[model samples]
Target: MMHRTQRQIRTDEPSVAAEALSVTHVTHGLTVEDSGEGFAFEERVRGTALLSLESTRCTGTLSGAVEPGRAMMIVWVKSGSAVVDDNPVKVGRPVLYRQDPQRFRWVDVQHDVLRIDRTIVEQVAAERGDWAPGPLEFRPRHVPEGAPLAAWWLMVRSVAQEVLQGPADVPVERERELARFAAGGLLTAIPHWPVGQHEPVMASTARFARAETFLLDHATEQITVNDVAEAAGLSVRGVQAAFQRHHGITPTMYLRRIRLLLAREQLEAGDDRSVAEIARATGFAHLGRFAGSYRQEFGELPRQTALAARE
Candidate 1:
């Protein structure tokens, strides 16, 4: 999740939103023009793999292009009608595209639209294990109704639901699971070749044991995820998945926890260093957040812990 989140976009005029949408963010390089029927736009997003709602009352064309195979573009019309990528888009059905949609244009003929772009697939895939495959391709077709489709649809909606109404702060394992669903689900649903052919490597718990050894050995030193990854002989993402899966917490957080414990040892031993000095030595650059987390973990402030030992 983001430390700071921007939920809604403000547009007093339809053309103003057109200008805002012109610039590319996590979505796509989209261009919207007012067809004189008026347009209403509001988008709320949290984390990657965004879900957007675009409602159009007038006639307009939405033209843009996204990179091929890196992501999937899906649009569902709950009401109204639209023409997407030169096909008369089916109402309440998902339309999939694999290639960069430069020529892909959508004409909203009195339509309301919901778009889901799995644009962060590459990022998520990097965190999981790697696979070697040829060029991936997704042929455009309708997903037929069935039990399998229903389950997948529910999974997709659940992710969106989690973002909209779920708790702001969740565990690392929870974050990993949500990201897996967003990226993993799209990778399976879309038609891809080599990239999707090989299974993701979920290494055994032994990798976590090795990583834990390294973190404990260097818990007092300033360390990074990359440093931990190098010590474990695994990619950064691989270590992340392993730690979260095995421990339900991230490697970095675990390191921080141990560092705090080590700092407390120093304080209890009547070290000459001040509390701030101890904090700096413990690899906590932000004194405030460190105190907050420390209080939550130990049920007392760092200074209080230090003073208690002295008493």
Candidate 2:
């Protein structure tokens, strides 16, 4: 299940602030230097076992060395400036920090950090048939810039607000999907592989048919692209290509369409359930989004459909 945790520290003592930072960040050898009398630190972290979204803000100068851990760390400085490993990081620029010890200094900085397990990255690489024998390596500092950077930030915030903020008892399957979503976004936003190293595999019509069947059969359940690929006997990339070539949409979109249809049916049938209930029953976790998408697809809100059915 996904979980959310928060911590805040406001104190004049540097030791207190340093302790908070080390505990929250799971860092080692963290030291606070010259806090200038007092500091405020706060962090909100929400994630499952595979990925974590951390938003941290510090209202004073903090400097320390962070040892490289097993997870891949991606950070975006939202407001203030920082220097990592003597490389100046600008506001709104994404930074991939991993595999090496990092010396950092932050002055009144607000940043969002994504920690994804290395195993998840490797699994994604394997799904794309891009995995080599050795450990997967990503360019340490090559993150998206300009419009791509904006898009990546948008994706991160969306997942943080929409998906990760859902009910704590969210199914394990949904958590897995969430992890994969984060991993996929990171892989897309960063440069990990050679541009033309892997050729795209063409998926046959039969494979697409099988995938479609699997989606229809399991539309209301939480499932990942990996499940679809397995059902279609194709790689994840292969299943995605199959969907795009056949229906001009991705497998996830197709599955969402099916769920929307199911939700509409339940609404129109006067199932005696609330709109939110029907939404969750049909695999929509966020009610506002469910209502919006329902309206867009059917030209009426879910309540309108149920009201008409009752009349």
Candidate 3:
């Protein structure tokens, strides 16, 4: 959840710029072969542990080869263009760089770039049931230039303007949420395996019951659908399908219900804890939201219920 904003690296020396690129972009063995006269490189970066969005502008000619790090980068040419590994990069087209060594030569290129952690892509692929037990692969080409590309472009821009560059004090949860959004958008825009395939299997009654029991047991702990799926021995999609088919609700909703019920029980027991304490003990994040949800589930707010129990 480390957050950095408006970090700038501007230099006129090729070696200095190369070193900066090595650290910021997480590349290794980067060597600059040619730096034409008046060479300049500048980058404005904003990022967290999950992803980074950068605006880079360079003048003159630069050529180098880099050992790709652990990130998957998508570059959108804004003003100028470059050739990535001999593939001609054009303006307005976003090119994806996979987790392989890259050779590049660019002349006066300015790019708006997004680098996402490879682990995030793999996690999303697993949750969508589109991945195997091996390395995740993507088509190393420009995203298709139609609705898909438009949607991905809009999403990235929105996230950059609103979440990354919008405010300095944004919540960590909001950052994680936007990172997941960008990851999901990237998967859709780029071509990958298991797309439009792998329909979830309906969970059996026994498996569904096991999932319910797991939720009830872990109601006071911070858990996710993936945890429930693991406990029930099912895929994430399978567990979601099971919940929809059996209870007409999501697994998250069921967990919330269990938490609310537990909170009510604590109140009825005349526990000497404040409503906020009860809400937090029952795993709610916000007191106001908890009170609203509690009132909706039962007939009164948590404080009202506690007062009645005292009477």
- Scored by lDDT, model 3 comes in at 0.70
TM-score of each: 0.47, 0.60, 0.57
User: Candidate 3 — which pairs collide?
Assistant: none
lDDT tens readout by residue for model 1, 95-195: 56545543445555433322343444554333332433234434346463322233235445556667656666556556556655555445433433334
Model 2, 220-309: lDDT tens per residue? 788899999998888999999977754446888766766776677678778678999988988888899988988887799999999999
Count of clashing residue pairs in every prediction: 1, 0, 0
lDDT of each: 0.54, 0.69, 0.70
Model 3 lDDT per residue over 79-163, tens place: 7658888988877777888677677777788888887777666665555442452356566564564334544654575578765
| Segments in model 2 whose C-alpha atoms lie over 4 Å from true places | 2-12, 34-38, 132-134, 194-311
Q: Sorted by lDDT, highest first, which candidate order results?
A: 3, 2, 1
Model 1 stretches with alpha carbons more than 4 Å out: 1-4, 10-12, 24-31, 49-61, 64-71, 107-135, 169-173, 195-311
Poorest stretch of ten by lDDT in candidate 2: 196-205
Candidate 1: the clashing residue pairs are: 133-194
Candidate closer to the true structure by TM-score (higher is better), 1 or 2: 2
Largest TM-score belongs to which candidate?
Answer: 2
Better of 1 and 2 by lDDT: 2
lDDT of 3 at 109: 81
